[model samples]
Every structure is written in C-alpha cells, then in structure tokens.
Target: MIQAPGKLADATVPHIITELPGPKARAQIEFDKQWTSPSVPRAYPVVPVRGEGCTIEDIDGNLLLDFNAGIAVTSTGHCHPDVVRRIQDQAAQLIHYSADFYLPIYAETCAELARIAPMTEKCRVFLSNSGTEAVEGAIKLARFATKRPYLVAFLGAFHGRTYGSVSLTASKAKYHAGFGPMLPGIFHAPFGHVADLKWFDEVLFDRLVPADEVAAIIVEPIQGEGGYIVPEDGFMQGLRKICDKNGILLIADEVQAGAGRTGKMWSIQNWDVEPDILVTAKGIASGMPLSAFVARDSLMTKWGPGAHGTTYGGNPLACAASLETIKLLEGGLMDNARVRGEELMAGLRAVQAKFPSVIKDVRGIGLMIGVEFDSHERAAAVEWGCFQRGVLVLEAGHTVIRVSPPLVITEDEVVIGLKLFGEAVAEAATKV
Candidate 1:
C-alpha cells in the first residue's frame, strides 16, 4: 500500500495577508485578462502562487482556504507529499513514454482501477488525459460496441465543451448556440423528473428517437456543473432497467463526482447500479492529468487497439500519481468524505435555516454539495463575498453555490468554511 500524503490541512485558514486582489494579483489579473481567452470564467480573483492541502497562497501573499480544489481535481489536496514524490520518482525514471508501447506504471494504474471498479465482472481500463476525452472515447466505444446510432443524455448535465461531448451537453443553450448541429441522434431527457424509466419508452421513444437505436444513456451520478443535484434512488434504479430493456449502454460520467469525492470510488456505486462504461477524472491523479473509462472486459475487446489510442493518455508520471492517489483515497479519504459530508451538510442546513429566503436548498452527498440560492444574483453575491473573505468557492447551474473542498479538509476547517459561508449567506439575504 502506498503511504497517505501529509494532509497539510489547517483549521484556522484564510490567513489573509493583503487585500483581496493585492497589487501583484491585480497586475497579474490584468496581464492574464489581456493574454488569456475571454471564454475562461474566473469566479473571483485569488491568484494562487502555491498551495498545500486545503489552503492556497496567492501571488499577492494572501493565504486562502481552497474549497474549489482546482475544480475538484486535487483529491489528495494540493501538492500531496506521496503523490508528488511518486510523480517526481516517475519523471526521473521516465517522462514521456509513448502510450503506443507498454509501461509498467500504466499497467499498475489500470490494475488498481480494475480492482476498485464498480462492475461485478472483470473490467478493462482505458486511460485518457481528461474527463472530456474519457466521455468522447466512451461515446465512440458505446456506439461501436452496441452498433447503435443514437445517444441520450440529461437536460442539466454538463458533459464537456468538445464537439461530441458538448453535443450531449444541455446545461446551457449557449454551449450549443453557434456550435450548430451537435452530433446527430443525441436526445435530452429532463433529469430529475424522469424517475420512472417508462418516460423514455413513452415520451422520448414514442415522439422522438427510437430507444432501440440508442447506443447509450450517459448520466452524471450527482450532476456537477449544471448543479450538484442528486437524483432520487428510484430514478437511478429505473434508469438501469430502461437501459436493460432498450439495449442501451449506461455510461456514468463521474468526472467531477468520482475519486472518493462522493465517498465512493465511483458515484454510481451509491445507487448500486453499475454502468457499462464508467468515465472518471477530476480527482483521479491528485492534480496530474489522468482519467479512465473502465468497462466490462467483454465489451472492451471489441476495439482492435489502433481503432482508438492517445499519445499521452497513459504517461508514466500521471500513472504514478494516480496509483498513489488511489492508495490515499482508499487509505482514509473516502471515509473522510462520508464523515465530513454529514458535518458539512448539517452546517449548511443551519445556514439555510438562518437565511431561508436566500437559500433554496442544501443538497448532495459527501463533499460534492450545492447550496441553491433563490436567485443567481444572490448566489453570485455570496460567491464573491466568500472570495473577498479569502474563502474560495465556485458557482454552478444558475443559482447554486458549490462547496466541493478537498476530502482531506478537517472538521475545524469545515467549521471555518461554514462560518464564512454563513456570513456571506446572511449578507446576500439582506441584499435587495
């Protein structure tokens, strides 16, 4: 077993040493704004120079609590010791071994994935550089394996920004505004409403596409970017039955919700429903670029290798980091998510109680949570307020403040975050 990384977590964090965006940060932000793409949606400026565990030291010399976790990528927290050492060790040994050839580290990473797979039967692992690539690859695999022509996704799911994955994405109309004809034959189902699988058979199949021609039905176990909306148990169970009846592969896009973020190796495991293809990333490699789409070995054998491949999908350094990350998650972070999740939820509920007019709901499992505000303006205000106070956070959907901190965050840190968050909520509530 690989050793767990030093948590590096501090309880009394957000040690602000300067103004929100001090002189250095202001200049850098201006520089970045001039050079970087306009499409990047930076919530609030906290220019990070270095990070450790649950805290970030900004370029302006202010230390802020990191609740965003680099958009839920740093599962083992920032610069985890074990993950860093493994990555350093692997980089010295080998940096860019082409994925075209075999690598021991790659095999080890895949093996660990197989061991933790939600599938009951033997599974195969395919590595990719990011979550979008995983979804894209799985899309191709689902179509090829099923020999079907159509795919179905949920209304509020944010799959990715790429053509094919973005085609399946329906979180915002702007995503498809000019993208024109999204890959054809993809259907969208109202997410939380379709608890019974029959909705697909009756409404979608009857009026729109034929269910039999569908290749797969991809879903985020707990919707992430669109909002941290957790579907009811019956909804997930019904989804499985629908897929079974329609000969459609079930794809769980656990990109933002996996890697023990939801207290499970795969978020779908919470529903006790296994997907035909499980696409996961975000927190997989502690910060290194890595994602894997694990599927039944039987289904994967369909691909004749060259049919699909990537240049840096299984880079040795990423593999090493992933291996260490899995060990760290298994060691204790998974349970930590579960335990801390309850504490966080209870705390958030208290905030909601205090400002019922502002907060609509507090929902999610483990550390993957969303606090729905009555209006997007209020949500934005609260997000900015938290940022000003040096506690990092992000917004999702239209009116939700997402609280997805690293799993290693301690109870005291949770208390501090909630205290700051509550203050922000109270202020937002009072706003006209």
Candidate 2:
C-alpha cells in the first residue's frame, strides 16, 4: 500500500483492473440474493467493496470511478479520513442514547448546522435518522406552526418516500402507488412558471385554499430524483415573495443538492432566496444515517415537547461523522467540487453538441448533473454502455442520465468517466 499523504494528491484518476461486477462480485450477488430484500437490488449491479477519492473497488478487485456518489450521499468521498476517524473515536466512546437523553455531540452538531444554514440566528433544529424523516418533521412543523391545512409543492418535485413526504413528492406515481389517502390539504402547482405570479396574487392563492389557511410551500432548489432540474431565474425568489405575501413558510429540500454538491453551502443560495425551513440529509455525515430539519425558533416553538421524536435520531457516532464531514466540505474539498464540476460540465456539453439526438440535454449547476435522452431506452442503453466500459452512473426522471460524482472526484477521473459516458452515448446512438 502507498504511504498516505497528509495533504491532497496532485494526480487523481481511476485505475481500473478487472471488468465491473466480475467473478467475485457475481458470487457475492448470488450470496446476497439468499437473504437480502428484493427491493434493495432494483437498479445497478452490486460490486463496491472499497472506495477512496472518486473510485470504488469491487469484490473482484475492479476499480470503477464512482459518479453516482451513493446517490449524492458521499459529497466528501468514500470513508474520508476525518469522517472515519470521528466515527471511530466517537464509536469507541459512546454510540447510542435513544435521543431521550441529552448528548454533547448532538447539541454541538445542531449548533454548527444552524450556523451554516440560512437564518441561523433564529433557527432551531430537529434531528432524524434519514432524509424522509426530516421531510416529515418539516411538514409537521409547518402545519403545526401555521395551524393551517393547505400545503403546496411543485410538479416533478421529490421530497421523500415516506407517506407525508411522498405526498409532497409529485415526481412519480410508483412512490405513491397503493398508498391511499396521503396527507390532505397538500396541493400541486407548476414550478418555474413566473407568468403565473399575478394569477397567484389575484386568484389561485385564495381559490386554492384561502391564503389564510395555507401552511407552507416545500420545494427543492434543484430537483434530484425528478432530474437535475434547476429552477428558472427568480423562480425561487418569487416563491419566497408569495410565501411572504401569504404568511406561509418556504421550505427548501436540499437532501440531494446541498452541502457543496452544487459548489455552494446550500443550492438555494445560488438563487439568493432563503427558506423558512431547510431540510438536508444524504451527504451530511459522509455515510452515516443523519438528517435534520432546521427552522426559525419562533416557527419551531409551535410544538410542545412530544410533537416529534425518533429512537436513533441523534446518535453520537453519526453526529461525530457529520461534524467531520461538514468541516471537510467547508474546507478545500468544496473548492475542488467547483473546479472539477466546471470541467465535467464542459466535457458533457461537448458530448451533447456532438450527438444531439442521443444526448437530449445536459444541465446542472455543479457536481449534481443530468444528461437527458430522447427516450428511456436510449438512456438505459447509455447506462449499460458505461457499465460495460467499467464505469458507474444512474438515471433520474423519465429519460435523464444522472452523473453526480463525489465532490472529491478529481479532474482526471472525471475525464475518464466522461470518456466512458461519451463512448456509451456514441454506441447507443448507433444502436438506435
């Protein structure tokens, strides 16, 4: 093994060996199938045994540059030293407390999170185990704070898969199928339609639910599962204005787009809009299961004491991991995301220009990116092509090829991943 360096490395690129999901990986899959749930193996083959920087190694000893970042969860890369050390040190000391008891690390994490989130001075936080749980808490807080029934979300928005969040998520039907009677008073509207502003002012605001009774409007600054759809200019600001006009809270769901993934602390910052409640998870703790709902103190005061609570909400190990993760993001790693993302996007745009038929559209702000295709089949073909070439990627929305690599992804690795993706696109185009 190469001796570890204290600072960042100069040259960073993937080194591939055996084919992806090779013999050892296939054997592992065969064993996993014996007990693992079927729902867990839906998309993407299983290999990933180890990872560092932007590359993941399969059980077969194949190294593949990770572009999905565990669905945008590992913004600081896999098992970052700081995060690993924190988790290790904290785990050795104390790991669980059921959240019923107070813990210093939990309180410290909350304090630091409030410092970075918008409106920190007046915000209070509630911790949770996963992204969906945080969304549920945010919704509940909004409803409780306003004592109102109506809530609004946009089409193609994904909050979470849980009941309340899934109801707010209007992206796909599969998440809501057979789950009868979602949270009532939840309404859907077209996002990015600025021309409809006056209509909301003169009509829909009251016609929909009488602005007085509307509680909040939840939106992702950049849509994740619905495609890396960035909102139009002033769209978020306009929403903030409407919420202000209607006395409704504006909730920003940043589970997949926040924490330097977009080259900023929060994706909403790009639009210069502040949310009353900000929901975040996924990359917060590197790989730990941690999510949080932060809201203004006054707004959070609506709940007495027992309004929300979870068994594994604020485990010390997760908080320690998160503390280290956030520190790394605020350091040089985020700057790397900015530089590497520009290079990756430019390369993808070049690919788009070459094959407009296969590559419908390439859009994203920073590391979170998407390459849309004319058809789902074409998209799937591109994915398979990349897989065959020993790279990993994912799909979103109807026909979008998602390309979100870890923030730690180096320029050379990105070029390699892009080359593989380009080859896949070219092959897919010929197939059609």
Candidate 3:
C-alpha cells in the first residue's frame, strides 16, 4: 500500500508557528508583485517554502494543511517520495531529449495511459505540457477526424486559457472579456441541464448549426472552476447517445476532475458513457507539467504525423513522474480518496447544517468537493478565515469553497482539516 511520508502521516497539522503571511512571506509577496505578471490571481498570501504530503510550510515556518493541492495538481500529494525519486533518477539520466527524438519513457507513459484509459478499443495518447495544450490537441484531432467545422461546449466549463481552448471556456467573463473574436463555430449550452441538450438537438441542429457540421461536444463531468456541479443522472448518457447519433465527438475535459481526484481515473467514468476524446492534466504527473489527450486508436489515426506535435510534450522527467504517479494512484491512493472524500463530505454536510444561511450547498465526488455559500463575499471571507487558521482552501466560481485535498491525505488529517474548515465557516458567518 502507498503511504504518506512518516513526518506528514499524522494528525497535528495546520501548525501555525507565526502569524499568517508573516515577515518573510510579506517580503516575498512584495517582491513577487514587483516582478510577476499582474494577471496571475493570488487567492491568499501563502508563500510556500516547501511541502510534504498534505502539509505546506510557509516562508515564516508556519505549517498549513493544504486542501487546494496546488489547485488540484498534486494528486499523490506534495513531494511523494516515489514520484520524487522517479523525477530525480530521470533527471540524472535524461531530463529532456524531447519526444521528437523518441524517448523510451514516452512510450512507457503512453502504454500506461492506454492500459488505464476508459476505452473499449485500443487507445492513443498525445502528451502536452498543460491542460490548455491538451484541449487544443483534442480540438484539432476531433475537427480533423470528423471533418466538421463547428463545436459544442457547455456554459461554465473551463477548458483552458490558450486561444482555441479559451474560446470553448465559458466559466467567467473575465477569461473572455477582451479576448475576442474567439475561434469561430464554437457554441455554448447550459451545463448539466438536459433541456440544454434538447435545445441543441432541436433548435441548434435544426436552425443555427446543423448536427452534421458539428465536430465535438466538450464537457466537464464535474464542473470545475465554475462549481463542483455533478450532473444529474442520464445527462452524460444522453450526451453520449446524442454524439453517437450525430457523429459528433464527445470530449471529456477531465483536466481538473481526473487523475484519481474524483475517486476514479477519469471523472467521466462515473457515468455509463464513453467519450470519444478525454483531456486530462493537473494531477497526472504529480505536480509536473504534463497533460494528455487520449482517444480511440481509429479516431487518433486520422491526423498525419506532423499535423499535431510538440517539442517537450512527453519529456523523460515528466514521463517518469507520471509513471510513478500512476503506480501510487493504482496502488492505494484512489481508494484512500474515496474513503476520505466520503468522510470529508459527511463532515461538510454536518457543518453546512449548522450554518445553512452561510453554506448554500455541499457537493462533490471523492476528494474533489465544493461547499457553496450564500454569496461571493461570504465565500471569500470563509476562505480567508481558513487561511488565517492555517488551512489553505480555494474559491471556485464565485461562491463555492473547493475542498480538493491531496489524495494521500490521512484519515486523521481529513478530520483535522474539516474541523478547521467548519471553524472558518463559523467565523465567516458572524462577519458576513
């Protein structure tokens, strides 16, 4: 069984050694503001010095329990020994010969992905550096394979920030306010609503864009960034049936919800439908920069070799980290996620019951959970409260506090974190 590092396997976490954003952190924040791009959002002033498992130490030596997992990127937890060892060993041997020159680790990573990808037929993977690149790759492959000109995406779905994927992203107005005209032929429908699907079939296909012209319908099984909104039953199945009938591809954007975050390899697997393309990243390489777009072999084969390619797509170091990450996830982290997620969700529901006015809803699968508040100000206050108490959390959409802890978080740690979260909610209740 996979185990957290001995130092971090215990409960007494969120140990605050100094005030939040203590002297050193404040200095660093000032330096960062001066040098860094203004576009990067800083939810809280957490200047992390180092991390192990579910705990991160700030520059002032305050140990904080990390529930955000670096925005759900560290599935196996921060600095997992096995993953780190693979990275170290691979770095010593070969860091980046580039996939253009055929690395052995690339083939190994692809083989591992094929073994786990949720496809009945043989699968093919195209590795990229980030979630945006993965989505872009999927878009190109779908359009080329289907020979279609249009695409369908859901409202509140965050594909990525790149040109092509950004066009498909409808999560927030800020992400699209100035960046238009977006890529043409991309249609947006309400997320997790069957009526939207029907409207697409009856109204859109009949009038706006013909079904035959559509290339793909991209969706997030559990909407991230927008909110941790799990679709009602039959919604995903309906999309699958619609895609099957119309020859339009179903692209599951699993960037934030996949890689064992939702107690499954891919969140879409929670439904009984199979997507034509699956885009995943964030937690794939245990915090390393790696993303992949997987599809059926037949569908992937339509594009010629040079039609889509990347220089550092499957770097050896990243592939090694990914291979070890898969091993850890398959070994025991996935089950741990399910158990701890249930425990965390139950605890959050109880907390929600105590403050119904503050917490509007609690929803998620596995460790990928969200607690909605009455308003954005309330959510922000609660998040700040958590941070002050040494538990790091993030705001999703406008009013949801996301609780995506590392998969390797221990049972004791979950209880402690939830307790802190509850306390934060109570504190925010009075202020808000």
Q: Among these predicted structures, which one has the highest lDDT?
A: 3
lDDT string, candidate 2, 1-432, tens digits: 111322222234344465656778778788988988875635667578777766676777666677888899988888777778889899889989877778889899988888889774478888998999999999899988898888888889999888899899988887788997897888888776677556566666656668888889899999989988887888888999989887989999999999878888899999888899999999888879999999988888778878888899867988998898888888766777778889989999999999987788898988988999999999989888887777788989989988888888766677788888889999999996
Identify the runs in model 1 with alpha carbons over 4 angstroms from their true place.
1-11, 194-196
As a TM-score, model 3 comes out at: 0.98
Which of 1 and 2 is ahead in lDDT? 1
- Count of clashing pairs, candidate 3: 0
Per-residue lDDT of model 3, residues 1-432, tens digit only: 756465744536888877888989999999999999999988989999788899898898888999999999999989999888899999999888777777889988998988899889899999989999999999999999999999989888999999999999998999988889999999998778666678786778988988999999999999999988889878999899899898899999999999998888889889867889999889999999999999999999898769999999988888988999999999999999999999999999999999988899999999999999999999999999999999999999999999999899888888888888989999899988
Off by over 4 Å in 3: 8-11
lDDT-sorted candidate list, best first: 3, 1, 2
* Candidate 2 overall lDDT versus native: 0.83
On residues 237-352, what C-alpha lDDT tens digit does candidate 1 reach at each position? 88998899878899999999999998988888898998899998889998888988999999999989698899999889999989989989999999999998999999999998
Best-fitting candidate, measured by TM-score? Answer: 3
The better candidate by TM-score, 1 or 2, is 1
